[model samples]
Target: MQAMTYHGPKRVRVENKPEPRIEHPNDVILRVTRAAICGSDIHLYEGLIPDTRVGHTFGHEFTGVVEELGPSVQTLKRGDRVVVPFNISCGTCYFCKRGLTANCENTNPNADLACGVYGYSHTTGGYDGGQAEYVRVPFADVGPMKIPDDMDDEDVLFLSDILPTAYQGAEMGEIVDGDTVVVYGAGPVGILTARCAWLMGAGRVIMVDHVDYRLAFARRYAQVETINYRQVDDIVLHIKKMTDGRGADVCIDAVGCDASGSHMHTVLGKILKLEGGAPTAIEWCINTARKGGKISLIGVYGPPWNMIPIGTAMNKGLTLRMNQCNVKRYMPHLLEHIRAGRIDAKGIISHRLSIEEIPYGYEIFTKKQDECIKCVIVPPRAA
Candidate 1:
């Protein structure tokens, strides 16, 4: 089997690896058909996430056919086409019972914070991901969803992560009818966040990014107003002016640790390794939101202290909600939206490459070249 293996920061390659087998009674083996390189994967590729060992496979958004089923796996059988949620949950834990699968106590009992996440790192329970010809899936009954007979793999691949993540981000905003919402970042998650805000009854949606191509892509695909922060003198003031001097009713920070705006944050976080990640986007979200407005954070941040404007948040009476998405809980609802043509989940895919082109795929995506909004990896069998 050929798998994408991480060597170090900015180093990944397609290398021949041993095929996966059923390791646990609840485990199943998937012959991967379609997999996506998520925005979070870049954090691991760049060494921003801790304990991302060399030779680790880095992919979480994937769909496949079940090839082998463990003895206890009764929900699925061999030859079942499924989209596996990135969060590995036992479905009976306190958090899972409460629909918070991302914090399942049984999945990553060793970790105090987040639960087991596929292909994230050792901190998230060192599970190998699905950027390969074959991959192991644990706790199969709880996580894998059967792809609809009418849908293709491309149509539902993102339900594994970004689609649900974007929906969850919008849900956390509590957007009311006719509310004005601003989303920071024009990456895949940001683009989908803008679209989901409209579904949640936000009358106006604005997306922000410094990259010209990404902003343009968001405007066309997500059907929202876009702002190039690089051109604007003050992004927060500009957003306020657009909303008649009252800041946006809701603001979302989709750009997490790798945000680029302040020199000090960039120098200290990305260069000096003094902080977890740059808080530039979070700062903008806190400042641009109206007094008592809601702010949703879908961006990935490490376990380190960030210089946030907590005093400003307190004085303004802002509501801040953030979490790693509970993907399994939202999968069915979002799938219905896709089936009804309410959301075009596959519309974000800009490039589709074979497993052999994994390295080049990462290069173009990270560099923001070729107007790349999203990239999907097709295994040899699927191709």
Candidate 2:
């Protein structure tokens, strides 16, 4: 089997690796059909994620067909189409019972303090990922969502991660009817976040990014207003101007890390007076929220940074909610939405390449070249 392996910053290779097998009694093996690149995977490729080691798989957002199941896996059988949740969880854990599936205790026994995640790093559970021809899914009953036989691969693939992450962002913002929502970053996840906000009944969805292509994509798909942070003098003030000086009712910082993309600069602007380097987008989110408004941080954070304004957020009486998406919890509901055709999650996919092209795909996606939003690495069967 050929898998994309991450060695270091901007270093990736497609090499032959051993096929996966069910290691745990609760595990199942999937013959991967479609896998999509995620923003987090880019972090790994660019060496942004701290403690990420070499020789790990590079993707987590994927859907596949079950090839084999462990002895205890009775809910699903061979040939079942499934979408694997990015977050690994045991449905029977205490946290799972409380609807906090991301914090499942039993599945991440090696995690000293946090829940484990697939293909992230040792700090995130040290588990293998699904960026290859095959992947072993532990805790299969809890992590795999059976895809409807009638649905197309593109429509269901995103339900694994981006769709859930987008939903989590909207939920974090407390989006509601008649509310104005502003989302930073028009990348795939950001666009999906904006789309989810509109679907959740937001009156006006404003997206912030400098990419004309992404902003245009959002407008076409979800009717979101566009704000290019590059052109604006003061992002917060500009947003306030658009919102009649009240700021956005909900502000989502979809731009992760202190390092910015080609369109934006740092994660935090120089205007923020924090001690170390703070994320510029986080700073913008803090300043862009109306008094008592909700702010959602859906972007990935790497290592520790300084220079964030806690005082401003505290003074404004703002509500902040952020975390890794509890993918297991939302997969069922999102599946229904997919079945109903309410969300077109596949609109973000800009490239589709074969497993052999995995290395080149990573290069373009990590460089943000060719207007690459999301690249789907299709297995041989998909061709």
Candidate 3:
């Protein structure tokens, strides 16, 4: 089997690797049909994620067909089409029972924070992801959502992560009717979050990003206002000016780690390794939000960046909420939305590549070249 293997930072290649097999009673061996590279995967690729050792395949968003099922897997069988959630959970655990599937206690041994996440790192239980021809899925009954007979693989692939994540971001924001919302990062998640805010009754939505193409895409796709933060004198003040000096009713940070606005943040976080990640978009989120407004962080920030503006949020009495999406909890509801023509989950895909072109896929996506908004990888099928 050919799989995308990590060699070092900004380096990956397609190489022959052993195909996966059922390792646990609840496990299933999936033949990946479609897999998407996530913004979170870029963290591992850039050598930012700790313990993302060489040879580990890194992908957490994908859909596949069940090629073989373990003895205890009852919910699925061979030939079943499924989209597995990135987070692995045991459905009966206390956290899983309460709908906090991301924190299920029984899965990850390395950390108590998140349940086992596919292909993230050894830090999240060292599970291989679905970026190859075949991958293993553990606790299969709890996480895999079946695709309907009428739908194609592309139509529901994002239910694995970003769609639910963007939806959860909007839900966390508590956007009321006529509330003004600001979303930072015009990447797929940010654009999707802007769309979800409208469904949640936000009267206006504005998106911020440095990229000209993505900002243009967001404006057209989400029917929202756009701001190229690079052109603005001050991002916070500009957003405040737009919101009549009160700031937006809700602000969302969808760009994590690599935000481009702060020199100090980039120098200390990305260069000096002083902070876990640059807190630029989050700083903008805190500063651009109205007094007593809500801030939702759907972005991936791995470690503690001591410079986060806790004082400003505290002083303004803001409501801040953030978490990894509990994908299982929202999958069914969001699937219904997709079915009802309320959301176009597959519309975000901008590029598709074969398993052999995985490296090129990474290059264009990481470099933000070719107006690439999102990438979907179609792993090769063996004869």
Candidate 4:
């Protein structure tokens, strides 16, 4: 089997590796068909996430066909086509029972925070991801959803992570009818977040990003207003003016740790390693939201020590909600939306490369080159 292995920061290559097998009674072995390089994967590639070991595989959004099933797995069979949620949950834990699978206590019990997530760093549980010809899936009955026979792999691949993540971000905004919403970042998640806001009855949706191509992509695909933050002297003031000085009713931070707005944050966080990751986007969200407005953070943040404007949030009576998305909770609902043609989830894919070309795929995506918005990796079996 050929798998994408991480060597170090900005170093990855597809090389022959041993195929995974069923380790637990509930495990299943998947012959990967489609996998994606997430924006969050860049954090691991850049060494922003802690405990990301060399030789680790780094992908979580994937769909595949079950090649083998463990003894206890009764919900699926060897030939079932499935899209596995990134979060590995037991489905019977306190958090899982409450539909908060991202914090499942039974998975990654060694960690105090996030539950086990495929292909994330060791902090989230050192489970290898699906950026390979074959991969192992645990707690199979609870995580992998059988794909509809009428749909293609591309149509459901993102339900593993980004699509549900974007939907959860919009849900956290508490957007009401005729509410004005502003989304920071125009990446895949941001674009989808903007689209989801409209479905939630937001009267207006604005997406922000310094990258012109992504902003343009969002405007065309997500059908929302876009702001190129690089052109403005003060993004906070500009957003305030756009909202008639009341500020946006809801603001979302889809750009997380690697945000590149403030010099101090970049220098200290990315360069000096003094802070977790840059809090530039979160700051913008806090500063630009209206008093008593809701702010949703769907962005990936590493350590808890990043500097935040807590005083300002408290003073303005803002509502802040954030978490690693409970992807299982929204998969069925979003799948229905996709089936109804309300959301063309596959339209966001800008690049599709073979598994062997993953390194180059990473280069173009991280550099924001070739107008790349999303990149999917097709293993040989599916290609």
Candidate 5:
């Protein structure tokens, strides 16, 4: 099998590797059909995530065909097309029972935070991801959802992560009718978050990013106001002025560690490694939100620390919420939205490449080249 093998930071290539086999009673082997490179994957590719070992594949948003099933998996069988959640969760756990599958205790019990996630890093349980021709899925009964026969793989591939994550990001904002929501970052997740905010009855949505293409795409796709943060002298002040000086009712940070705004944050966090990934977007969210406003963080940040504006948040009595999205909890509801044509989830895909183009996919996405918003990898075998 050919897999995206990691050598080091900014180094990945397609190479022949042993195909995964069922290793647990609840495990199944999937011939990966569609694997999307997430923005967070760039963190791993750039060697930001701790213990992202060389030779490990990095992908989580994928859909595959169940080529083989483990003995204990009774609900699914061979040839079942499924989209597996990135979180490797055990449904019987306390957290899973509460619909918090991302924190499933039974999986990744050794970790202090999130449960086993596919190909994130050793900190997230060291499970290899699906950026290859095939992947092994464990706790099969709990994670993999069967795709509707009428739908194509492209139609629901994001159900594995970003779609539900975007929806969850907006839900955390606790938006009410006529509330003004400002989303920082106009990437795939940010744009999707803006769309979800409107669906939840937000009267207005504003998406911020330096990339003109992405901001324009957000305006067209999510129908939200767009701001090129780079053009403004002060993003916080500009947003404050936009919201009539009171600040937005809700602010969302969708651009995690890679956020490129504050020089102080970038130098301390990304360069000096003093804090965790740069909290530029989080800082903006805290500084620009109205008093008693809600802020939702759906961005991926690394461990250790982030220099956040805690004093400002406390002073303003802002409500903050954040978590890796519990993908299982929202997949069914989102699927309905997709089916009804209320949300064109697949429209976010801007690039599709074969397994051989894995490295290229990562390159264009990281460089934000070719007007790319999202890239999906199709393994040659599946192609």
Candidate 6:
């Protein structure tokens, strides 16, 4: 099988690799139908996550059909179309019981270190990922959700990651009826963040980004107002004015480490120029947040922190919620929403290509070309 393997920094390749088999009795193998490249994949490509080993496959956002099942996997059989949750969790764990599947203790063999994840690294449980011809799904019964036959792949692929992540951010922000919410970053997750905020009854949703194309897309597709930080010198002041001087009631940071004051200061230096001054989305959130408001962070982050405004948060009495999404808990509800036509998440997809064209797809997606919002990799079906 040809799989996208992480060889090293700035180097991922489509190479022949061994096909995965069910190693655990509870595992099931899926013939991948569609897999999307996530922003997190860029972090790995840039060597942000240490778990990415040479030859490890590189994706977590995917949907597929069950090709085979382990002896104990009775809930699903071959031919079941399913969306695999990005996180692998054991339903019996304490964290899982509390709906925190991202921190499941039992499935994370390296729990003393970090939560285990598919196609991440040995530190993240050493499980193989789905950016390949097929994948072995650990905790199959708990992780994979059967999708309705009538639904398209792009509509529900997000249940695996971005959409749920965006929803989680909105939920954590405690967005309520008539509240004004501001989301930082106009990436795929940010666009979905605005959509979810509106779905939760937010009166006005403001999406912040330096990229004119993305901000425009947020305005058009997500049904939210957009602020191009580069074009506006005083984002905080402008947001306040837009909200009648009360500021945003809820602020969600979807840009993660890419924003100013983030650990990846060097990267921010590169992209911030497009948005003018420092790319301080986090700072903007603090400056523009209402007192007692909630600030939710769903962007992927790495080690060695820097330049966060603790005093601003303290003075404003802000509540901070940060972490990865517990995709398991929200998968069922989000899938229903997709099937019911409540959300048209597939609109975020800007490109779809065969697995063989992954290199080209990565080039365009990495450069974020032609208003590229998201890219899906569809491996050719087995002959």
For each candidate, give its TM-score against the true structure.
0.98, 0.93, 0.98, 0.99, 0.98, 0.92
**Per-residue lDDT value at 244 in model 3:** 92
Q: Give the alpha carbon lDDT tens digit for every residue of 1-383 in model 1.
A: 99999999999999998998778999999999999999899988887777889999989999999999999998998999999999999999889999999989988756587989888888888889999999899999999999989999999999999999999999999999999999999999999999999999999999999899899888888899989988999898999999999899999999898777478888878877777779988999999999999999999987667899989999989999999999999999999999999999999899999999999999999999888999999999973
Model 6 segments more than 4 A misplaced: 112-114, 260-264, 267-279
Winning model by lDDT: 4
Flag clash pairs in model 3.
Answer: none
Give RMSD (Å) of candidate 5 vs. truth. 1.0
Q: Which stretches of candidate 5 lie over 4 Å from their true place?
A: none
lDDT of 6: 0.81
The TM-score measured for candidate 6 stands at 0.92
Writing each residue's lDDT as its tens digit, candidate 5 over 254-345 gives 99988785688777777777777788899899999999999999999887798887999999999999999999999999999999998899
Off by over 4 Å in 2: 109-113, 258-278, 381-383
Better of 3 and 4 by lDDT: 4
lDDT of 3 by residue, 30-116 (tens): 999999999989888886667888899988998988999889998998999999999899999899999999888888996556789
Sort the candidates on lDDT, descending order.
4, 1, 5, 3, 6, 2
Better of 2 and 4 by TM-score: 4
Per-model lDDT: 0.92, 0.81, 0.89, 0.93, 0.91, 0.81
Cα displacement (angstroms), candidate 2, residue 56, comes to 0.9
User: How much lDDT does candidate 3 score?
Assistant: 0.89
For all the candidates, what are their Cα RMSDs to the real structure? 1.0, 3.2, 1.2, 0.9, 1.0, 3.5
Comparison by lDDT, 4 against 5, better one: 4
Report model 2's TM-score to 2 decimal places: 0.93
